[model samples]
Target: MTIQLKQEIDKVYEEDYLLWLEQTAEQLRQKDIENLDWEHLIDEIEDLGKAQKNAVETYLRQLLKHLLLYQYWTQEKDYCADGWAEEIDNFRNELEILLRSKTLYNYSASILEATYQKARRSAFKKTKLDIFPSECPYTLEQVLDLDYLPE
Candidate 1:
């Protein structure tokens, strides 16, 4: 690609992302290698991976938070149990759907400990409970189990 074309492509990416997307798609479909925005395309693809990783981690963290509330924090159980249960269900369902992306599923392990720690801290903040185990209480499978609930 000429310097001018490359600059234009980069400009479109910043000024009008939709146009950049359409142009990129057309370029790929037409196999116009000369005009393709290689750098931006590479960056976008890498960003997609990061986005998927972050999304999976977010789901895991949320799942852990609700599970912690449901399993421990006994004082507010009467008032919050049903709501917490519903949230646990929602987060699990979301994780199941997200896990269909193989990248997210494979990357789950890398984020598990951090996600659990964040969940523990969040639950601790709300309940002022200091009794939570130093480690995660549930395994990844247990958290994702549709039928599992802490007792």
Candidate 2:
């Protein structure tokens, strides 16, 4: 709690980040609240939450893109459908892991519409096709269903 101790922790945070993380964990585990690096710890925690939400958004966008391509890009479907399906499965699996947290699941649902718009644009850009719908075609339930694929 002394000025010198705070300065030492700050120096470690700047010069040796891994060491600072270890020290921070130890301090937290021991409930040494006085010695905690409050500012940096708060920043790191916020960043972690953002990272999780960002990851879910990314995966959902990718899944939607591939789904669009696979279902509607008939010209290339024969050649690329299998690869697209595989990518969809991969993204879905990644999403499943992240969405296990109820907070993150809700976060994903909250962003679904905006994320769909982004994915729609990406699909159009990639295929240079005008067939994709202006609104999202898949519901969250359908999108998350492992057994579901558009006919």
Candidate 3:
């Protein structure tokens, strides 16, 4: 098939993304470059990478927020404290899986400070206690550690 055939189903990207994806892959596998939807295919591939990186940053941000709250919000500790710890654990586990890919690993590591900064601001807002440090207190390794808790 020619790229003309791919263009015939151009609307499929918005109407039936799965079919568009399948057709795109078929074009690649069959070496039908002439029929390939170059622009949308490149966009989808780039978006997929961005989505993965966003997930990593989101989980890392949550983990950092909960850890900061658990450690620094000294006055508000109560029945919910354990829940915060559990969230930290959950985020760490999710990140562990997401970070297994080398690209994602580096992506996550690179954004640690930005994620921590965002989380820290949110943590401060949640706790309303200005006692936390100006910078991230936990290292990425420490944040991911199941055993580590701030003293």
TM-scores of all predicted structures? 0.95, 0.95, 0.90
lDDT of 3 by residue, 1-151 (tens): 5566656767788799999899989989999888778889889889999999999999998999988888877776676688888898899889889888989988877898988889988888887877778888878789878788776
Q: Lowest-scoring 10 consecutive residues by lDDT in candidate 2?
A: 127-136
lDDT of each: 0.88, 0.92, 0.85
lDDT of 2 by residue, 7-116 (tens): 99899999999999999999999998987999999999999999998999999999999999999999998999899989989999999999999999998888888998
Q: 1 or 2: which has the higher TM-score?
A: 2
lDDT at 18, model 1? 97
Better candidate number, 1 or 2, judged by lDDT: 2
Better of 2 and 3 by lDDT: 2
Q: How would you encode candidate 1's per-residue C-alpha lDDT over 33-145 as one tens digit per residue?
A: 88888899999999988887788888899889989899887888899999999999998898898899776887886678888999999888988889677799788889889
Error of 2 at 20 (Å): 0.9
Task: Give the per-residue Cα lDDT of candidate 2 at 54.
Answer: 90
lDDT of 2 at 25: 97
Best by lDDT: 2
Off by over 4 Å in 3: 1-7
* Deviating ranges (above 4 Å) for candidate 1: none
Q: lDDT for model 2, on a 0 to 1 scale?
A: 0.92
Q: How well does candidate 2 match the true structure, expressed as C-alpha RMSD? A: 1.1
